[model samples]
Target: MALMITDECINCDVCEPECPNSAISQGAEIYEIDPNLCTECVGHYDEPQCQQVCPVDCIPHNPDMKETKEELYQKYMIISAA
Candidate 1:
């Protein structure tokens, strides 16, 4: 599944650079994760880098944008090709 940044985000800049897909960005409020560009770091890391580096642990799986691991890998391949 893709990940999302909740309101709990402290606006700490750490997670943005840690995202391999460049999916994290500063939204109107906190940092946001674009589901279209997010592959849960499947093609780059074993786990979500953003979650690891986030000081407040505000990143979590996006229940509304769920996808299997294989699907995530496919998304990763498509993104990498671009």
Candidate 2:
């Protein structure tokens, strides 16, 4: 599944750089995760880097954008190829 930044985000700007796919970006308010670009670090790291470095613990799996590990890997492959 992709990940999402909740309203609890402190906007510390740490999670943006941690995303391997560059999915995290500054939104109108708190940071936002692009589901299209988010692979949850399936092909880059064992764990989501943003979640690991996020001091506020605002990042969470996006239930609305549910995806299997295989799906995430496929997405990662596409992203990597491009």
Candidate 3:
């Protein structure tokens, strides 16, 4: 599943750099995670870097965008293939 940032974010910008896929970005007020770019670090790291560092713990799975590990890996592969 792709991780999402809730309104709890402080716009601290901490999670942005932590994302290996460069999935996280600054929105008008809070940060946003791009589903196409988010692999939950499947190809880059052992875990979701953003979730690991977010102080507010606002990063969590998007139930609507849920996917299994294989799907996540395929998504990562698709991006890397490009």
- Segments of candidate 3 deviating more than 4 angstroms: none
Off by over 4 Å in 1: none
Mind giving the per-residue lDDT tens digits that candidate 3 earns over 22-54?
A: 899999899999998999999999989998988
Whole-model lDDT values for every prediction: 0.93, 0.96, 0.91
Model 1: ten consecutive residues of lowest lDDT: 12-21
Residue pair clashes in candidate 1: none
Q: Which stretches of candidate 2 lie over 4 Å from their true place?
A: none
Model 2 — TM-score against the truth? 0.98
Instruction: Write candidate 2's Cα lDDT for 12-68 as tens digits.
Output: 999999998999999999999999999999999999999999998999999899899
- The superposed Cα distance between candidate 3 and the true structure at residue 6, in angstroms, equals 0.3
Q: Clashing pairs in model 3?
A: none
Model 2 sits at a Cα RMSD from the real structure of 0.5
Against the true structure, what is every candidate's RMSD? 0.5, 0.5, 0.8
Q: State TM-scores per candidate.
A: 0.97, 0.98, 0.95
